[model samples]
Target: GTLVEEVKGRRFAVSGSGFWQVHPASATTLVDAVLAGADVRPGDRVLDLYAGAGLFSAFLAEACAPGELVSVEGNRRASADAGENLADRPNAAVVHAPVERALRRGALGARADVVVLDPPRTGAKEAVAAIAALEPRRIVYVACDPAALARDLATFGRLGYGLESLRGFALFPMTHHVECVAVLARA
Candidate 1:
């Protein structure tokens, strides 16, 4: 089954039990945060790693018209949904592979102007070096775990990426869970 969610006037098709943000307001909040931090320019190449059902990729694709937006996801169902969700955008493509493997195999291309990633609670420790290797101008990281985010941020720092700005959101309400969107830039 497919579930279509409308966020900030954009429709996203999520298939099966794919990873859609748990919070009702999460999609819009994260999209706004990422777009502001990305500062994407026209014709700029963008990469959306760990993309789930093309949530952020759809918006980025519009912002970087005539450029390219490569969305990579490990989950089979989610990737399929992403492809369908972004079908209207000719400049957008969805790759079904783990973020680490895709980056290692150069599946995303040689360079990216901006990179937006929403890794799981464990974060993207394994893909930090490879992502930094792309030398993107800006990296917008959406993290669900503070500990994992800190560890990954430290790794990014050593790779010449400095934390430019970070915003935290209490999307979980009563729970202690907090979502943090951190933007990093090559130094």
Candidate 2:
């Protein structure tokens, strides 16, 4: 990873670590999926889980005013970098902790209006439950693995979240890996 990279015209430090490594096209696809049917209000609070370096948080910042978004990541370095990336965003705070622990620990309360999560290839099982606990109106999940996405979707279902839209992207090209973005709404 490069020390600094640009996404959607926003530049940030990657720290030579590929935490949020993904093709630019894939990134665009994921962001597009999240923004497609998103109903973000100006004063709505947003929870960004697995918010490596505040990628999607930038979007939230644009939609909501300052102090309306909380971005959580497990990696310390990535979280630190997120601090800098989201520095200009006074309202978007980065919490350096795992998504599950952060939510389970009550890092983010039930005040979130929307939640955007871009978990790793393993997907987020417990984290999904935690997000469900928040009872946000909408949830946008960016999944790198189909199997994990399926399992987590079931968990969301059990938690009373309904899958509204799902889109797949062949981001890796010839590789078997496909990125899927799913938007879920509370039922």
Candidate 3:
């Protein structure tokens, strides 16, 4: 695993290693996703599922100024780095646990105004289900895998959420890997 680095001018901290190595484009894509679809407001609660190194969590904390921003990460090293990265944010909470376990425990409480998910290539089935169950006002999904994104979007659609918009970013210029952002809202 490579060392985590903080993105300048943003509260996010991202790892330099992983299945999708953190590069300038990938980091920018994540920030762009948050900026385009967060729909955050003061006093709102935000959830960052599959929050690696506090990237989305930090962004939400800064952009939303919400009542709280809960970040969940399954990897130990990533979680530890997330804790260190988000330590300065008073409204942020970094939980070192699987997204599913955190959601199952109701760690996010009854409601969240905004939910952001940046899961792995496999997508986030259980996390998506939990978000649906919580019925957040807005959902921002960042995916590196289009197929998984489509599958998860179908599930969200079945749960009464419609895809509002979609955007693509060329994170890996030389490779087929790309970053996609999707906004979903209740129908």
Candidate 4:
């Protein structure tokens, strides 16, 4: 099924498959948080990890006009959908590969200005190691689980990155689930 999500008055039609929730408020929070945390600049390269429907890809590509934006996703359908959703952005590219494998193969490029990863509830331990290797200037991580976020922050510490800021949102609206976005920069 196709669902419409409007973030900051910008509309995006996203596929509802792919084992993730296409919640509008969550999308807005993530997009806003990433932009605030990354402080993207023109001509900066950006990497979107676990880019389900290319939401952040569109956001980053438009913000950093003419800059390079590459989004990596493991699911085939979601990748295709992202490709279509991000079609208008000439600076964006969607790779249909898992983040770990893509990083191992050097597909997402090296040392981007910003890297945004919206990992699943289990967290992105394996992917963070690879993301840290990218040495991106800023890392905007969107996590659904606090424990996972904490653990990844620890890994980033070991890699010489320090958490710049963290913001929590009541994305689940009264549930125990909270969505958090953490920003990390080189210390």
Collision count for each candidate, in order: 0, 2, 0, 0
Model 2 TM-score, 2 decimals: 0.93
lDDT agreement with native, every candidate:
0.92, 0.82, 0.81, 0.85
Cand. 3 Cα-lDDT: 0.81
State residue 67's C-alpha deviation in candidate 4, in Å. 0.9
RMSD of 2: 1.7
Write the residue-wise lDDT of candidate 2 on 100-162 in tens digits: 888887868766789888888888977877788778899988888899999999999999999
Best-to-worst TM-score order: 1, 4, 2, 3
TM-score of 1: 0.97
Best by lDDT: 1
- What are the clashing pairs of model 4? none
Per-model TM values vs. the true structure: 0.97, 0.93, 0.90, 0.93
Off by over 4 Å in 4: 19-23
Candidate scoring better on lDDT of 2 and 3: 2
Instruction: Go through the candidates in order and give the C-alpha RMSD of each one to the true structure.
Output: 0.9, 1.7, 2.2, 1.6
Candidate that beats the other on TM-score, 2 or 4, i.e. the better one: 4
- Candidate 1 minimal-lDDT segment of 10 residues: 15-24
Supply candidate 1's per-residue lDDT for 30: 87
Write down the lDDT that model 4 would get: 0.85
Pick out the ten consecutive residues of candidate 3 with the lowest summed lDDT. Answer: 12-21
